[model samples]
Target: MEQIVGSGKFTYDVNENWAHVPPGIEMKPAAVAVDSRDRVFCFNRSNEHPVLIFDSNGDFLMSWGAGMFRYPHAIRFDAQDRVWLTDEHHQQFMQFTSDGKLLRTIGEKGHRSETGVPEDDFSSQAWRQVTHGGGPFNLPTDIVVVPNGDMYMTDGYGNARVHKFSADGRHQFSWGEPGTGPGQFNLPHGIWYDRRGRLLVADRENNRVQVFDLDGNLLTIWPTELIGPAFFYVDDEDTVYIPEHNAGMFSIVTLDGERLARWGAPIHKSIHGVWGDSRRNIYVVQPGEWGRVRRIVKYTRR
Candidate 1:
């Protein structure tokens, strides 16, 4: 045995630093996503090559988005395989061809809402400053597009709300406010559509993942088992891979909010992003202080 980690059938053989960029490239890995073709994309908060692509065998395919974003926050793919990206400092949602050609952009570049937090400040506790829910983004975090072409982005960090858009990228409506009550969020960091067509919002500061209908009705909440999730990636089987930002743990849970497998050390902080490939392998990325997560890890399926 190769020192398996995780639990139950979701165990894996850990392969740390599975990929590397050329000399002088910085990958403060912010978020990660896997395409249908088995290519893994690491979206980082780096000035150079913000997007790093790799094959399932851990081969460096290519790098893109050099100087394209101030701080690349999230990455997701549509059914057509187009890349959907979000920028924190820039405060915009971006669309691109799979090869990294820009197709469109949303939101005002460098314009943030009236959240108490300033555009330049990114302290972890800044959520306390979000007095009210604002517009499209203020350090926007993650984006998810459903089958009907409706999109949802977790406008967290500087603001506490989720913005929904139509297939054409028009703002349909927005929901949530700064609070601990149901339908309210403290820091709605990550987002995804569950297998049952319900909306799942990672209410990070409140230490729970709140599920809602598309109309913004609160359904249920998944309290952190002493973990604060930063992002959520749902696999084909409806298992959720959550990277706990506060406790530095990785949790594999089900649609019913049951933890299938959870693992990590206390020293690990900001396990910011997670993605599962078709081969049952899991990809994890961390965005902490520089010189951390020197190489992103791939948890090979056991």
Candidate 2:
């Protein structure tokens, strides 16, 4: 596979491919997280089973989590190397060992029976009908960990807020509401805690990034002109890489929202997710008409 770097428009590398399609499984790859060993874990929304795993070379290693997961949207690795996943459809969060052992599960599932159900009503019929809950999470899109081991999750989409949890998956506190206010969110999709402990959230529909303190206090907003800035990552040098799902490309920006590099052509529409490995190789999830494909492209500093 050929590698491309620097800031010129490029076509999707049809040669450099890394994907794992296990038997009886469909690949609706939504998120990718690489462990310390360079092993890639891809989470899909196609089935309620164990997420898919692939080696650095994209070879199928193993699979786990059968009979578990409702609508797994995001996969993340903590400092301790533990694996965490958020199920937006069922309003639940789960923790697992790097090898896929179920460590713990958070939030409740089931249907709502009445109107005006409280946001935390885990079993209300209304809860089942809507995506955001005033409680645990109506549809958690992403998760991140602070330096202190506390976790921050974007309880976005159906619900417009972010929830904080202890390392043990215990709910600590949450912030944000359904509005355009500074503290409120429209669709808080992805989240990350920068090296400075400043919370960075991908306010997708709002076309901006919302900064906050560890306590959920609104700090400021950075406008990103890209349509649907769904997910992003902040590198060691504070370079922010945001994948624009609607635009079919990714932008490398600074903390102040300056575009550094842009890649991908219009043919690669729906670039839903992005991740970089220790080798500075950027992996993107491109879901197109046929199916979802994972492309691993290497980049270098200019």
- Name the weakest run of 10 consecutive residues (lDDT summed) in model 1: 286-295
Pull out the clashing pairs in model 1.
none
Q: How many clashing pairs per prediction, in order?
A: 0, 10
Which candidate tops lDDT? 1
Q: Taking the tens digit of each residue's C-alpha lDDT, what string does model 1 give over 115-211?
A: 7786667766777888888888788888888899888889988999999999898998899999989889988988999879998888887888999
In the range 1-302, model 2's lDDT, one tens digit per residue, is: 35554454322333334565666776677777778887878777666544777876678888778778766678888888888887877767788998788887777764321223354544312222333336556656788878777888887656677889897778889877666667777777889888776888887767778889998887878765766687877766777888887677778888877787776666666676777667656666775444446443323332
Residue 283 Cα positional deviation in candidate 2, in Å, after optimal superposition: 1.1
Candidate 1 residue-wise lDDT at 138? 88
Q: What TM-score does each of the candidates earn? A: 0.94, 0.83
